[model samples]
Target: MLSTRRLRPSKNKPKLPDGVRIYAMTDIHGCAHLLKQMLRVIDADLARSRPRYAIEVYMGDYVDRGPDSRSTLDILIDRSRRGNTIFLKGNHEVFLGNVLRDPSLLTDWLRVGGLYTLMSYGLAPSPTPGDEERQHLVQAFARAMPRQHLEFLRKLRLTFTCGDFFFVHAGVRPGVPLAEQQETDLLWIREEFLKSRQNFGKYIVHGHTPVRSPELLENRANIDTGAYATGNLTLMTMQGSSMLAV
Candidate 1:
């Protein structure tokens, strides 16, 4: 059965009362149907003022796994153009960056849901073009992506802090100021973040590790939840220190 469970607000992240309601979602992979439904839920929530969180975000892995990555990106890009959207770079986005920088890595990337991107772009079963054609295909694909999406992907913050919350696609390195956190940590670190005893100062919310449900805790929350094949996208909302999931 399709779930429509109601989530209560969290005490750590606050909701916006005067402006947008501030909704954050993670790891869509490529499930377009759930993306559509989530968008509807956000809109409907805002329209009815039901716990009211308006700003919507997708915390990476927007493509791959599912068959509708292209359409999924289309919806995100369109909604983003209208304003009040935040798209973070998940490990999958990192894969895109890597492939564009060096197509030779396509084989490795394809093993982790990247095959969908090549197929979406109408490419071959084998990795990608060889020495002579790499530049052409890479440049074309780069140019084809929406400028804003590229900019968003490129400029994504390693760590984002608002109120008492800190967010990264993965987790940050231990014992480092939020400003000094490394890119490798933001895009990859997992075990260190999970094992650290000292508080990283703020509640870190991340989405690198996949889970069946939103992993909410005092230190960090893993919201990846593998939505691509399951057709379920998990989102955690913060309203004035109260946490809620939709």
Candidate 2:
């Protein structure tokens, strides 16, 4: 069931710097079309509102599953150059980096939409590539990936923190201090972190689990609306003590 409802601000709001506003979105999964649309909306909104300080935070999974993965990265890279933007690494991104270092992981990556990402770069690998073919494909991918795009992916942040919000790709581990959280948990934790109702010190703004709608809980806001499959690329904004989604 696709959720058509808009996300409302949570009761436990945290104040950001007086003039700063954050526009955060997540789990793009190569949905370049939706990404483009959302950016336009955000830009228009900012222009209309005239906020003093604006920062864009992307919660990762920029490649695979949807069409135009390469184009998706291109858009993000270009956008980052234009202004204040932060990109975080998702589990899929970790998998991609690992596969690039070790071709044997290619089959595993493909099982979870890595093939589509390759297609975006115009490299079509055989379903069961032999050792030689795998190496060849790896080389091809290295050659095909734009230098800036590769650097962007390599330098993606694991977590970003603002006044009272902790932004990560996935939820943080329960009982762990935000500063002490492990990289693996930051990029991949699910059930343990999701089910916990305990205070995480600061509200965690994340996207990984695909909820039907935006999960605007007191402790976290999950804005990953599953754009790759659902066509609903959600964006969450936090300004001062208020949050909203469109």
Candidate 3:
């Protein structure tokens, strides 16, 4: 995998030009190649659009369930640091953060398919890898992982607003302001948000509860299509309320 350590950025990441139209992505479960494909499409669209703007918000899941979590995080951080990407936290990141806090959580994470992340970071499960081997891979991956990658995961915003839209990793708790949204629901919600029929006031774009394609609900959209699992990536064009498959 391409090292992400070099891709990490320093403090005060630059902001995007919010006035321009945007294209968003979510639940990128470590499919590094698919992300490249998506970027190519975004570039083509940007080149053709009048006035030439770029993509904006992206929902997260940059790790786990795929072959190249390290590469995936590296690319997203690189693009966002370039000032045209907005990233929201997904449940996978939250789980990784938890594991970092308590390595014992590795079982829970492993149960949820986080072994790919451990492998990306150069760690192993049962009969933990030998020290020399572990240290070599760890140092290599650590050196390559962008520091901002962890910072990005650490300070990931649960909710953000751009124009009339509110973007989150997962849906908000019903009746809660974007300001008061619970982090748990933001990263892990599925049912309550899915079952709700009322308008959520501001339109929400999120990824969670994977589908074959973007699931367009009356109030929000699910951009997760389980790309890593199904070899399909779903995207929503911020240019308008439209879905694009890559």
State in Å the error of residue 99, model 1. 1.2
Q: What is the alpha-carbon lDDT for the whole of candidate 2?
A: 0.88
For candidate 1, what is the lDDT?
Answer: 0.70
The pairs that clash in candidate 2 are none
Choose the strongest candidate by lDDT. Answer: 2
TM-scores vs. true structure, each candidate: 0.82, 0.95, 0.81
Give the better candidate number (1 or 3) by TM-score: 1
Which regions of candidate 3 fall more than 4 Å away from where they truly are?
1-19, 50-53, 127-146, 240-246
- The better-scoring model by TM-score among 1 and 2 is 2
How high is the CA lDDT of each candidate model?
0.70, 0.88, 0.70
Best by TM-score: 2
lDDT of 3 by residue, 120-230 (tens): 766554534444544454455446556877777876766777655678887888887778777888888888988886667677778878876566655776778788888
Which candidate model has the greater lDDT, 1 or 2?
2
How many pairs collide in each candidate, listed in order?
A: 16, 0, 7
